[model samples]
Target: MKPSPTFEERWKRLTSRARMSIPDDFPELPPAFHTRVLAHWQAQPVESWEDLLATLGGRAVWAVVAVCAIAAGFVFTDFHEARISRPELEHVITLEAWIP
Candidate 1:
């Protein structure tokens, strides 16, 4: 049987294949490339129940919050809004549309 490669051997193979000379902070994609990629994704239609499910699953947090709020007998939006309004609450507020 062949001997297993050491970690250094595996890392050397990986780095050699992708020989990126740019600094880590350099952006790999251009701004126009991002726009084109976004347009491509938007143009592709969801074609199946599984696709629909996947799209819904990606937004599943709202469903989870709704279920929990229903079980607790409170309006889900109100509960979430109240949580956000609390002065002592420290949470990162993000744009939900971009939050996936």
Candidate 2:
């Protein structure tokens, strides 16, 4: 069986395979094409926040707002414990007493 190649040998082989040479005859974009693209971009109107919200629609916006409000309510509201009955408290106390 042949011995495995050293790290330096493997690295040199990988780098030699990965090396790329640019072709001499590279294609170039015409000046007129660049001007036409720039003019097309300039002709398009800039959209505002109102335009974006309008695109989303009223119902979608309200649903998002409602979801955020519900999330906030859950995060901010204090959770209160329900009152335990005497028998329930006694049962817990008995279980705790047995642990000792």
Candidate 3:
């Protein structure tokens, strides 16, 4: 196998391939190019939560919120029913009746 090149040899090989000189007489950009770029940047609409909701429409947002509230209501009612019908409470009541 061939040995790896030294650091100096590697650096020189890299630099020789990248050697480029800029010419003294580069042409200037047109004045309108700057103003056009600035105007394009300024004309861009900044988006926020309100803009996002507006794009989705008020009715769609309300529908999603209503669906979530319904799901939450179902979950809460089931949890409450489970808590009320616990077997441990019935067992405790039966034990108290036997003791008394």
Candidate 4:
């Protein structure tokens, strides 16, 4: 079987190929490239705290609504329980005859 190349041999081959591939005359970038790039980067919209708050703000409202709905449900259950415990009090609380 053919032997695999060692790390040093592979590195030497890689470096030699890279050296040979170097451009004879590498073109220079446009003037003020860094300034333009920095300007563009800075101009981008905020993607951190403001974004998190905007996203979570709606979710927070939803969470509050869900919690309130669950609480209201539990309140009804408690009302039902209280009613079941003291059946005699229904006559005083309501004008209509108790059905159940």
Candidate 5:
């Protein structure tokens, strides 16, 4: 029985046969080459940090929303006093735990 071809041998044969017998505008590429060509075609210029920051800064509503959200989180979730209660005679746990 014959051994199956290795990936490199199969790819070379596939690509060699797949090339334009009669050249048309488009031909299918090998899987490896497809990603590179697609990436090149899809590439765009990236925004700078300052440009990003400026865009974020322009939205006054987000700044207000962020501040209010932070304020609400601080106000609502914090325990003003310990929920647990124990006898004072046992040298009971003081409110010092609540200070921080």
Candidate 6:
């Protein structure tokens, strides 16, 4: 099996065989393509930061809503001063048993 020609070799052969005939009045590429490309790349981080801020802002609003809901639940609860019956302290906790 033969290996495929490298891009440089293929390009050379293709260009040599068929040269495109561009009109003399053909419009050239826009000036400073490099500068435009660089500017776009540099501006990406700022856009990303704005997106991050937007996403975090939405999450923060949800977080505040959840906290307010939880606070309301606690505030509406009937936390009575009910008497808690207890066993003798000696029977509840045995230091000698815990040490072993």
C-alpha lDDT of all candidate models, in order: 0.76, 0.85, 0.86, 0.86, 0.77, 0.77
TM per prediction:
0.24, 0.37, 0.33, 0.35, 0.32, 0.31
lDDT for each residue of candidate 2 in 13-52, tens digit (9 for 90 to 100):
9888777544467679899989999998899968888998
lDDT of 6 by residue, 1-42 (tens): 999999999999988767665445866668698789889888
Clashes of each: 0, 0, 0, 0, 0, 0
* Residue lDDT tens for model 4, 1-100: 9899999999999999999988899678887998898899999956899889998999999999999999999999987774444565666566465553
The window of 10 residues in a row where model 1 has the poorest summed lDDT is 88-97
TM-score of 2: 0.37
Better of 3 and 4 by lDDT: 3
lDDT of 1 at 20: 82
Across residues 1-100, which tens digit of lDDT does each residue of candidate 1 receive? 9999999999999998778864678657989999998999899965899988888986798989888878877665656763445443433334444567
User: What's model 1's TM-score?
Assistant: 0.24
lDDT per residue as tens, model 5, 1-100 = 9999999999999889888475786866779898887787679557789988888876967889999999988777765645554566333445555444
Deviating ranges (above 4 Å) for candidate 5: 1-3, 21-56, 64-68, 79-100
**lDDT by residue (tens digit), candidate 3, 3-89:** 999999999998876775444677888999999989998899577888888888988989999999999999999877746556988
Better of 1 and 6 by TM-score: 6
* Global lDDT of model 6: 0.77
Residue 25's lDDT within candidate 5 is 68
Error of 4 at 45 (Å): 9.3
Ranking by TM-score: 2, 4, 3, 5, 6, 1
